[model samples]
Target: MSLLTDLKHDEQFNASEKAVAQYIITNKEEVLNLSIQALSELTYTSPSTVVRLCRKIGLKGFKDFKIKWSAELQKEYNAISNVDPDFPFTDDDSYGEIQKKILELFTDSLNQTSQLLSPDKLERAVELLLQADKIGVFAYGDTYLPALNFQNKLMKIDRSVHMAALPGENRHLATNFRQGDCAIVISYSGESKNNYYITQLLKQNGATIIVITGNPSSHIASLGDLILPVAESESQSVKLSTFSSQTAIDYVLNTLYGCLFVSNYDKNQSKRIASETLFLDERF
Candidate 1:
């Protein structure tokens, strides 16, 4: 029987032990590389209890148990592998197939966000974004690419905007924010410790926050003044995927820019366009 099936019959364990064991089994996909100490803290069980549990399960010790458990989880995940969007797609795929995939991803994402996103939350978010005198964006991994794109887009319209191209471990750029500033944080899982600490620091200083994440329930979401949910599709082979989430973020930025343009309708668009056209010769 699987660990899950075996657990249903193992009523000998106390509630706490049972809980710890279940967490370890259920999270094998996420915790395979974790050491016993890390797993102990994650499962909230003592190291001794962890070892004892492994022996009880007929394993030699914690290390052997974790490896076996991880193998089982991997086998199970492999069976459902096709469900993840990171599956290989040839560059020569028909345009229709690409279009259909994109539509399906975004359509489901929109529906989910529509159901979960409240009108009051959006109003509060927009108000914060509009009121900010400065903006700081921080992201890492695949997420940083989108942050750079957003920074460039924002800078084109607002010269005063500051983009932290790379926020290292210390998040040194976080200190530049002031009371009227806003911090825009992006993370696929919404759980990067560095980003989370930056959010906490910004909030403590009275800065508004905008968080874009694939997992809305993640720790980073709780700190956001505005939460933007991105769609995610994961796989066992490929550890992470960015296609759908990046598309969603780009759409949000475009919408916000449109709103800004409408709000500045009284300003002359021709002058702004001309100011950006300095590279072209007068003959053109």
Candidate 2:
């Protein structure tokens, strides 16, 4: 929990400490620019009392409190509302405004993706991956970014995942994969002809297919054994870039990677470091 949260509910604080806490919480904007002595003066408390309150929240002194508190304030400030992911900023927007809008879009996309996530589907997907004889990921273009990322992390934990980023190369994986194997198809639109051909081959070979796409009703999504929704608050083509879809895809894949790691936490955690040391020389 944050220091502010502790101040509001930590019952051990006495009247003087509570008064200092109240002043800090109420005058957050002022506190951002306040010194330790100035804060004590405003709360009508001694400097020693302010230091005590800081220690109560696990901080060493007033400087530590101010730096952490400033970060919390900045996080709250970035959480804006009603920001359309498509065309989030105008042509005339300044560089700082563009940066803020992009951050807002990412925050909004992560929330939306979490809302659409299904616990049952997630459990089932993880179970299939755990039992699969082999695993392959099919993605091209922008979606290939997350496919490559997932493959990298999974490899560190000793889960070998095949991902072919080049066009004709993925066809080989789809065609050669076996009946008990698993295939993850990442296509934001769920209507890519490129993905559709490979999807057919995977189905023909009796591989279990997991689809991550924006449109649940689209052709590719309809073919999957399990479908996970993609958060697509932005337009498919008329937008500045593939911001929302990419963010949501990365979020979903990362969540899957986390769950996979936790399934065998102790071994996986140690194995990751061992893998890095064995395969990488400069990691330290």
Candidate 3:
């Protein structure tokens, strides 16, 4: 994991450590040139606190932390300088430029997500899905499409998947989940109150919950039994479109579908082919 990702995901850091981390993240370029005492003074902490923060993040000391952080920052700078993932195209961009920018946004989003994905967490999520008696997918707004797509994919493989976009219907479906069942919740911010309540309801029923979210520190993420973290560049634009989050969610769901399909490859392939054949026959 990158130091920034680790700082975000790891909750063991105390207030002082987090403060130091935030300072380092915000002042990445300047950190490499600052002495331990200088950094501590800048962050309103002490040199010992800085050293402790470094140790907590798996670095030997301030020097090692600077070295690793500098390298990571350089890589990030080079990547973003090529194509700004968050705002790849502007209002004045030409048609061809817009197309190219959109492509770059999606490609970079997937690559960043892939780099941060944890194989162990993915395997565990698949195991939970395979063991569940029923699966419920939950999402709101723009994320609902990917959730529905995942439901359709699972249904093709003969898995019972349920999803509800409405609040009352979501609650109803969540309430029906029992022990040995699983709920897959998709939310980029992981702060939707509706999804939070739904996840709470699933927990109340003793069902396992898998959360696919971009924010690791969100409340919904904390409630998850298994979390699929999606890394993307943060954006504050009020644009109607959400590019990176949706792409990340789709990629994670597709990866999960692939893993599930391969777990029982022969049976799944037969079922999928048979389903397609039946549909074609009905249509023709």
Candidate 4:
């Protein structure tokens, strides 16, 4: 489990212990440089509370917690330093410079996403998708393109998948969802009100929910039966468009499609070849 997930879900932690855990999560970089006393002072808790929090989370002590936290932080820092996803190229940048920066941004996004991805969660998602009677993809705004891409890929493999980028169509689809179905929602912020409503309706119909988001702590992520977290570049300026988020989403969808393709390789391949032949015959 992620440290944030553990902190959020563990019922054994008291208020003070949770407070220390939250402090560590929010100020991980600073916590790496602080002593137990310093951390306790910052969190307004006792040193004993800090130690207890660490132990509860399966860390040996404050030092162990700091070491693990620091490692994760370092990985994030390296990814961010490699690229600024929002403004990867500027007007002053030459064509070569722009190409190099875009390549760096894509590489960094994939690398960081690989680091953050949980193998168990991925396997679980695959299992659900394979067994689902129908797959419904939901996304809005910038994420809709990737959602449509995913739907197209799944359709080629003879899977029952549905997606609607528009709100009215999406609402109709969500209402029609049944038990044993699965809904995959793509949202970078993981806080879209429309998504939340659609997810609720799906849940009411007993469909399994898979959420792909850059924000792990968002409410939408908490509702997911399976959560796929993507790495996001930390930039000081607000982003007007999503670059890394879309890249990460595409990577995840492609990976999932690959898994599905391999599961019934002979059948899927034959179907794909037949489909290609038919299309070619018509065109020719």
User: Which candidate number maximizes TM-score?
Assistant: 2
Steric overlap count per candidate: 0, 0, 0, 0
Candidate 1: tens digits of C-alpha lDDT, residues 90-128? 453334344555566666555554555555655666577
Model 3 agreement with the true structure over 147-247: per-residue lDDT tens digits = 88988898889887888756579888889999999899887888888889988999988999999998878999999998899975756456547887889
Q: Clashing pairs in model 2?
A: none
Residue 169, model 4, lDDT: 88
Residue-wise C-alpha lDDT for candidate 2, range 83-172, written one tens digit per residue: 777778886454545677888889889988898888887898999899999999999888899889999999989899998756689998
TM-score between model 2 and native: 0.70
Name the candidate that leads on lDDT.
Answer: 2
Question: Worst lDDT window (10 residues) for model 2?
Answer: 91-100
lDDT comparing candidate 1 with the true structure: 0.66
Across 1-284, the per-residue lDDT of candidate 4 in tens digits comes to 66657777758899898788777666655677899999899889999998998898899988998887767655544444455687776775444455666777888888889888877877888999999998889888778887788788778878878887556788889998889999998878878888888888888889999999888888888888898888867442486457778888888888878878888999999999999999999984
Better of 2 and 4 by lDDT: 2
Query: Which TM-score value belongs to model 1?
Result: 0.58
Candidate-wise lDDT, in order: 0.66, 0.86, 0.84, 0.81
Better of 1 and 4 by TM-score: 4
Which parts of model 4 are misplaced by more than 4 Å?
A: 1-81, 234-237
